[model samples]
Target: MSENWRLDPDRALPADAEIRKQARAIYDEIASLPLVSMHGHVDVDLFAANKPFRNPADLLIVPDHYLVRMLVSQGYTPAELGVPFTDNGGTVAGAEASDVETDSRVIWRRFCENWRLFRGTPTRYWLEHEFAEVFGLSAPPSAENADDLYDELTAALARPEFRPLALLDSMNVEILATTDSALAELDSHAELARTLGPDRIVPTFRPDSLLHVRHQSWAKEIAQLAEVSGIATDDYAGYIRALEQRRRAFVAAGARATDHGHVSADTTPLARTEAERIYTAALRGEATAAEADAFSAHMLFEMARMSTDDGLVMQLHPGVLRNHNARIHEKYGADKGFDIPTRVEFTRSLQPMLEEFGLSHDFRCIVFTTDETVYSRELAPLAGAYPSLRLGAPWWFLDSPEQMRRFRESAIETAGFYNTSGFVDDTRAFASIPARHDLARRIDAGYLGKLVAEGRLGPDEACETAIDLTYNLPRHAYARHERNA
Candidate 1:
């Protein structure tokens, strides 16, 4: 048997023996709770189609950027990683050439050979966890058992328990909210809501098109919005009405919040005259670069106002330098894990929107950042002071265990637990949701144990906090509280 290298409870413990035991116990208490995935990109079609997943490669390697990116960084071309060459064929193109090896044995051999590349990473941990927990694989994957394990996993996947909905049930997911664009029909979400009930499957509103002035699809996106809302997209007033119309449709489709992924958090609330002039230029597709930015900023402020009135929570994730690699972007398109972090200034950038809506009880805004420097300096303080503001959990590049711990330590001091919205698994890999949540829970419990050992919080309070952090906080954070409250 290849020796298994699983992380034990004591792996992250402090040097002190007594303190380590207490931390281990606390971590175990909440580690098995049902996962709450508040944000993610798992295709709703997975459930709506109700089709069995075809093979191990398609399910495990293709849809995940983490797996593909890591492999790419190790000098494996994306095509070799089974990420589509064409957007649709991207995932399966490599698999065809790979299939010429014909035997599942060959496929497993290749994967086993590359196993060492993932050591000591969260992806490794999650992959191992899934293999053991989901597929009953105890022997570590290597050359010897590669064919055996592949055949075994392939058989297991053919079982009904491996169905997407069945996997959700097995993971004990209370809810799974898929992010959908404003222009999307949400038919899949609707189908799942009907079959699984509205409470189990919900849609998150992601209106990224509204923030893009330079995208090729801007004019068409606006026209589509107008069509959805039965309004014209030619003028400023009509655009606002069209956006409003789309927001209502999203709500009807079971959205509780709107997600904005702007390059920065600059929420410039320009005057009506300025906005109208900018809008006119945008409609002509002749806006100056500065005018385009102004229009997007103005829309951010308007989005906040709409959130206040319509009761959809607002979430802003800023400072991603998207499409940083032009050639790669052209070939592979966006979200190939090429986006990098940039310095973010939330205090000044978000001031305009916060001034208008931050104090309103009706508005609920959760802000996310890739720039961790802003956690203590800007995000925590703003969320601490503003009634509507809540800091989103550590996200994207910062979702590691160390980063999660640092976030809680840095932000909890100023913003406290309540001011920070709870964990969101924010992943494209559906199976990793449970693993991600488990990692977060372990880290949070470890942090809470430190507080208890230091006498900052009593044991009972620490236990309660653990439960809230693991389960309750997410339910509350993503709930339609503004509508209900």
Candidate 2:
């Protein structure tokens, strides 16, 4: 363990003395404000059961793709990191099931031994915050203290104060939105509604599987959606109707938005007959790749139309090439952190959808991309012009401090502050939520302080802008769901 371990109160603030002083004052104003988690992947069932985490490894290392990917990149296999293997006879390359580590203590030690690998990364910052603020650990993780820390966490997690709902209250989270599939029953969400009350844990509709007709399991998922919605989906029109019904169910269950994870931002609508033909081919398991892409693009347009009618905000996260590592995917399943970003173009791709609903008062779309090149050249200009479009915060691979600064510098000139959605921690690791949000708030304070120091913005204006970026903007962007809840 590093004996010098300590988190500086002014970390990530401006380095200059005067600017750091200004930034610290701004940070203090919003540091304790209720967190509005507008987007995340935390499982609602954890709250439904209010169960203690199984172990330190299960809680920290297993589900976090960010950590798992880093460990794997450094020559550690997924099996060594305690990642569960698929039950359907999947095996890692050049490794056998017998080699997999099953003891939580062993995995924890391995992680501590390699703790230095996380230096200078956001993962290190988040882990430090979680270790000190969340878990109240006095020392940093090291090979010598791994077992002791693991035991401490295990005991702490067993207490009622550390239960899911109790921890949420302690964290001062006002709202948390979870991503759910279109075919999901949402029974856990319903349980959370009764346990935690309405809007505490809202669900967001995710239809990525349904949109990609070329996926091997598309037909199976369609059948599941039909069963859940009680609407036949054998034809194109029926599929649309089924999706609409699911959206209604989501709204009734306190959903405020629909999330799309597309490979590109293509939203060109196909002619009705062509859409039907593609749907028919997909149903027959014969749709070509080109046809599937066309169908997915058209479905994006249809989703926007549905959002306009239902009043659910639409969030588009495009440009990720998911499952880029076939070997890992075939061995461990999706979300192994093999997804990579590709160059994306939004101007021409979104023209059809934007032309249709860009001026609609009821329609709202928040676009996110890992490709930072589009922030200034395309996204900022598009958001500046469209009443319904807003740029999403830096996400996925770009959710680091340096990238966040670059994002603000590039996009804020054109889109201004209001045309951007506030920070949303798109995290699956529940404990990391506060840490991630804290990082964003500190970064925003530093950025705003610089503006005030440079005389570009008044101190009062900077403070108000900081508040909006931290609180008001997220509430406004997700207002419909908050109102419905």
Q: Candidate 2's error at 267, in angstroms?
A: 0.2
True-structure lDDT of candidate 2: 0.90
Per-residue accuracy of model 2 over 53-109 as CA lDDT, tens digit each: 889898899888899889999999888999877654545565677777889999999
lDDT of 1 by residue, 1-485 (tens): 54443546555445566666667778877878888888888888888986787777777776778887787787866655555443444234233433223333444566667888888777876787778766676576777777777777788888999899999999999888888888888888878888898878788888887666667688888888887778998898888888888888888887888888888788988889988888888788888888877777788888999998888889899899887877567556677778888998899989989888888888889899999999999999999999899899998888887788899889999999888888888888887888778777777878888888888988788888888888888777778765633
lDDT at 164, model 1: 91
In model 1, where do residues sit more than 4 Å from their true spots? 2-16, 87-110, 482-485
lDDT (CA) for every model shown?
0.80, 0.90
Worst 10 residues of 2 by lDDT: 86-95
Question: Whose lDDT is greatest here?
Answer: 2
Give all TM-scores, in the order shown. 0.93, 0.97
- Candidate 2: residue pairs that collide: none
